[model samples]
Target: MGIKKQLGPIEIIVNNASVFDKLGLEEVSAQELDRHFAINVKAPFLLAKSMNEQLTTGSAGKIINLNDWRKARPTRLAYGVTKSALTGLTRTLALSLAPNIQVNEIAFGAYCHPQIYPWVDHVRISA
Candidate 1:
């Protein structure tokens, strides 16, 4: 039997995967923009749609989107634009999926990237 048969329908979805290309406007390419959006925006949308259907009735569900508040930052164009699109999607989903599913977004600040601080020890990266 499928998971639905064994357990039940999915109740929560957390969109956490994101592409953060450190390329600015002049250096950012079309493919980069597309790739960023494909992962950052499209994936969440598809997942949300699926979850919305699976949770159309019965108990309540929740969709939490992990967002970066640096969407307006000038250093990252594609990431910012896609994040903005996600914000719009989140608002629309919140409005449309109300009563049945709760769609929410949690904007986060910058943290240490492994590439940027390779020696900082991934566990204790507060430095």
Candidate 2:
């Protein structure tokens, strides 16, 4: 009845869900950072871990970790920091899942996702 039942197993996972609220270093709270990391880093890590476990012998799986170019930027401090951390996580995951499950990252400088990233779509560029 569910997607897993119909599709057999999760072969490809796109860790795409994340929040990017613009916040300065002084504006970001502990809870805000925790929330951002939980969604951006922890969720993707957990999904990859679960995928590694679900994979059968000789079968390959794919994990695409979606990130933004703002990871190094000063704005959106918490989101930036979390995404930076996720890059490290992705690298380690790729090493751990070698030959079977491949983990990769997709960094977007400009993109649109009305539901998840409404701001990106409406952001104005003066340059």
Candidate 3:
């Protein structure tokens, strides 16, 4: 018996929990990669599975996954890999949970202090 079952129905779920550790390809260990997948990918899948019944019963259920847009950054090797997998998960879930639950993803760009990333101005200008 989970909170969703106890409370009856759930209309929306936001999968925002993620682990962003800056580690290069060579620096990332197997355990770190597993951890990244567990938190960034598996957790959302489990949550959505658990809430499937309640979500289907709702008038309009929604599931939003917080993702990242930067894909080729070498510093975020494992993180990027997991996020890419999550993107696929979002697409798959959108198809599988259709008619009842709407699955979507919000991909974010680089988020750092303006002073730390002066190049952000170029992105802003280009956009």
Candidate 2 local distance difference test against the native? 0.86
Q: Pick the candidate with the highest lDDT.
A: 1
User: lDDT of model 3 at residue 62?
Assistant: 85
- Kindly indicate the candidate among 2 and 3 with the higher lDDT: 2
lDDT of 1: 0.87
**Cα lDDT of model 1 by residue, 84-122, tens digit:** 999999999999989798999999965666653643444
Please give each candidate's TM-score: 0.80, 0.81, 0.82
Cα misplacement distance, residue 3 of candidate 1 (Å): 3.1
Query: What tens-digit string does per-residue lDDT give for candidate 3 at 69-92?
Result: 875568889898999999999999
Clashing pairs in 3: none
**Each model's lDDT:** 0.87, 0.86, 0.85
Q: Output the lDDT of residue 58, model 1.
A: 73
Select the stronger candidate by lDDT from 1 and 2.
1
**C-alpha RMSD of each candidate structure in angstroms:** 4.8, 5.5, 3.5
State the lDDT at 110 in candidate 1. Answer: 55
